[model samples]
Target chain A: MSDAAARLAYDVIVDLVGRGSRVLDLGCGDGLLLARLMAEKGARGTGVELSQAGVQAAIARGLSVVQGDLDQGLADYRDGSFDWVILNQTLQSLVNPSLVLNEMLRVGKSALVGFPNCGHWRARWHLLLTGHMPQQASLDYRWYDTPATRLLTIADFRSYCGERGINIVREVFLTDPDGGRPTRWPNLRAETAIFVLAGQIEGRPRQRP
Target chain B: MQPRSVGIVKTEYVELFQPPNELRLDSGEKIGPITVAYETYGTLNADRSNAILLCHALSGDAHAAGRNNEEDAKPGWWDDMVGPGKGFDTSKYFCICANVIGGCMGSTGPSSTNLRTGRPYGLSFPVVTIADMVRVQRELMRHLGIERLMCVSGGSMGGMQALQWTVDYPEMVLSAIPIASAAQQSSQGIAFDVVGRRAIMSDPKWRGGNYYAFGDPPLDGLALARMVAHITYLSEVSMRRKFGRRLQDRERYGYDFATEFQVESYLYYQGDKFTQRFDANTYLYITKAIDYFDLAASKGSLAEALREVTAKFLVIAFTSDWLYLPAQSREIVSALKVNNVDVSYCEIESDYGHDAFLLEVEEQERLIGNFLSGVAREHGIA
Candidate 1:
């Protein structure tokens, strides 16, 4: 696969992974992103995939991956064990995205979370036009069979971070990594967004927006 | 039982040290002319980097796979996972399993006569540690011209050796699979071993480890030890499924204490079968060594112990294995994670308990096969 074969969101996430840093990829499916991150960024990577087949595929690629449920928590990992903990395309599928987000920041010095924005204009337009839940490639599955239990938008994530005192170190819209950060209406324009976050220190003032 | 092509399979013995080339034990005692019984499957490539060391658990021999003779009814202990197309995949990788130093199956143990005393070492044998066991295996590897191993894989006590190899000789190993093992033997584990030892020592036939001259050979004591230890290897769920409160060979219990329960009969059979082959003194020595294996205590903490490890690790645990619970494996994983060691862990769902490493074959086969293939690719081993 070419370096550009990764999803548009991964391209942006890979850039922020930096060089030679340790990474823990939560809900790593087939470990493609971790493998790409390792190859391109010189990052030492580990994956925690819940499925046996996914774990097998990752191992086949010569990647280190453990099989475990994210909902059960990352208790096996120590505090700040990894330089970056990534949750890509998996945030919406989590049983408790809030608790998992807390764990991601607990185990990793910095967390990079990528998720589809439910509040995208297309989704909103589909809901307004058809009077039903949106169905798109980013959120492709039917509501009945979908693994996504929680669907949140960029606005929702920003608010959650604010409430949890999580410092948003960096945010990038999937459609534009090099372009200036989408300052005006990312919740409406961006299909998916990646946020680099760190837990706020006790004495420091929280970053609200 | 299926028809499968076998690989190059044979067992051999090698004398590592001589009178001059003494092997100094961790206790600072010396033993030379040590013999190690080993079996190898598949061919070692020119570089000899395709070798995967398979360490055996307690009561396990060097015969890891294949049958010794046509008349033999069963294959090696880990036959399901060590053949041509099996987990270790002898067809692609050269696999070696050696009888540990303090074992009874052909390796120099309490059963072997000491060169200096002209008699079995018995109680006089220098107590061996997990590290010492690895040291002996290293000597065997050196003698075999294997500069580095592709991977070292094992479970339980075997897993301890695998983990020890990673900590002790990190550069020499490319990867490690330590399944159903812990960084240190838990206190509860020690208590079980203590009871096992007590049963052996209490036997009048034991004669303070000088019972080799007698005909009986402390069978009762050794059988009792095996019975106790075997129970620990299995889970309550498995026991309930297999035996429950069922009676042996009858519709109802005889009501007397003469092995009425089917489980009792099964344990008796296991105990009897074990005594037919195993040496009682070796049981004492090996258990003592296993109990003494506290990697964390020796190296400070598990993190400190694994701090310098460069080899990737796959640490496996079983859900119901109370003997070496998943919690223990997690401790090792936590340390590896803390030290930034590349590690993978799977707490497999199984009712087989600690014996799951031996009994629950499919998941391990898949995991190990994939992990080994991955490691082989990394090491450029065809």
Candidate 2:
């Protein structure tokens, strides 16, 4: 909701998008990332968001956005539509992330997924000391009214990816937007991470440091 | 640099039979002074009630039937269908065609002057919807003293605008025929248009929407956009049959991006020719409006939208049109049924894709002419 969080998302998108790939933004709020990708990188792209206000805002910004519900899979798209399909900070909010992610992989050759880490030290410490899920800056809502349907850890995600045979091409560990850089012990410390996954097996999938 | 002049294949303008005209845009912008570039063959009846409106498609102008002078070898694009005793029956109906707004022809669009700034509007033109296009046609008719049109018809984007007229203003139209049109543009449609616009803006010549001063427009981008669209207008089967593995003046590949196959050459020519006439900004606006189109979404449901229409309907779809499939046309028929509207539906079996509605002369003429005559008899148009 804050400007800082939005800017951080934009920066990550800038680093992830290729020079000339067709990009599709899922839950593309206001299409900020899409506009940047199209303008600066010469990438062709559009956004899908359910909110009419968000769609209108994106269109006014001269970015293409189609109003759509996430539950309806990306069946409308032909095969190999986009090189990159992005789901930024919207993975946990979906009713069925697995189904949506599968649809994403079906439509795009690769995907960039960024979400708050449930296994971060702060979150773990809160659960260890108290009995409730930690209310952090990113995941700031309480259990009673939070939009997050599932709380997932970095390890749990990687394990699930392996079980599904989804090749993880690139894994990025992140601290708070303004905080220190990520190092070896990311699972214990980093609050967020970005993963690039492909549906089929490919050479050197991981670009981990 | 010298300006290259190609040989004149065909060129002419259409004269307005009824001089005075008024046009109202969907944005509620109306025009009193009018100029229509149209061609005609037959005479108007004494009552002038046998007028048939012919809607033009996107990137198409108003020149139909023939040129300004009578000595041209070839006729206009749809001349085959709108002739004496033909599908349109120029002998019976005063067929009229006008270039749609946001069109590059004589009609007003982004390239047209702002009238206030005294400069080309460029991106400043207000976004006009399909309904706005119909409003302009209705105004043109009203100015010509035409009340209750005998039948309104067109294909592709023109069909889209015609459909809008039936919903937006049914009283003005007696019978409506929309060919190869979808009730709503799917998300994939929006995606393609978004890419096309992005391609145009990506050109350095685009110059952030101020390219008019540079004397060099974004021709490459516009051409690329057109090539992308041209692909959708044709069927895969047709493409395969016509240009499959046919080498372009060679036995093998050139190891470069030059036109290697016949298909590539055809597409390149189509795109290259298109950029010369179409305003890049108008293409952006019109295509965006098409992407934003959802007749059902506007009025809550397709049935709800058709409930407002008092006119009879005849909708047609091609079997091979992947761009706007037969299922989409059927959706409109289903909704019309729910509203208890008198509607006839037909899905023509053809391999011509979306272009079939434009290219197939005999079949289209027969269907359209018969439908119009039926509407005329019921409505008592002379």
TM-score of each: 0.88, 0.60
lDDT per residue as tens, model 1, B17-120: 88788898999998878999999998898878899999999899999988887767788899889888889998898989999998999999988998877988
The DockQ scores of all candidates, in the order shown, are: 0.48, 0.01
Clashing pairs in 1: none
The sequence of per-residue lDDT tens digits that candidate 2 reaches over residues B189-282 is 7787888899898988887766776789899999999999888889989899889989889998889988799998999999999987787887
lDDT of each: 0.86, 0.74
Stretches off by above 4 angstroms in model 2 are A1-209, B1-41, B69-74
Residue B54, model 1, lDDT: 98
> How many angstroms is residue A44 displaced in model 2 relative to the true structure, after the best TM-score fit?
53
Over A71-127, each residue of candidate 2 has an lDDT whose tens digit, in order, gives 666665544567898998888899888888888887778888988888889899999
Name the candidate that leads on DockQ: 1
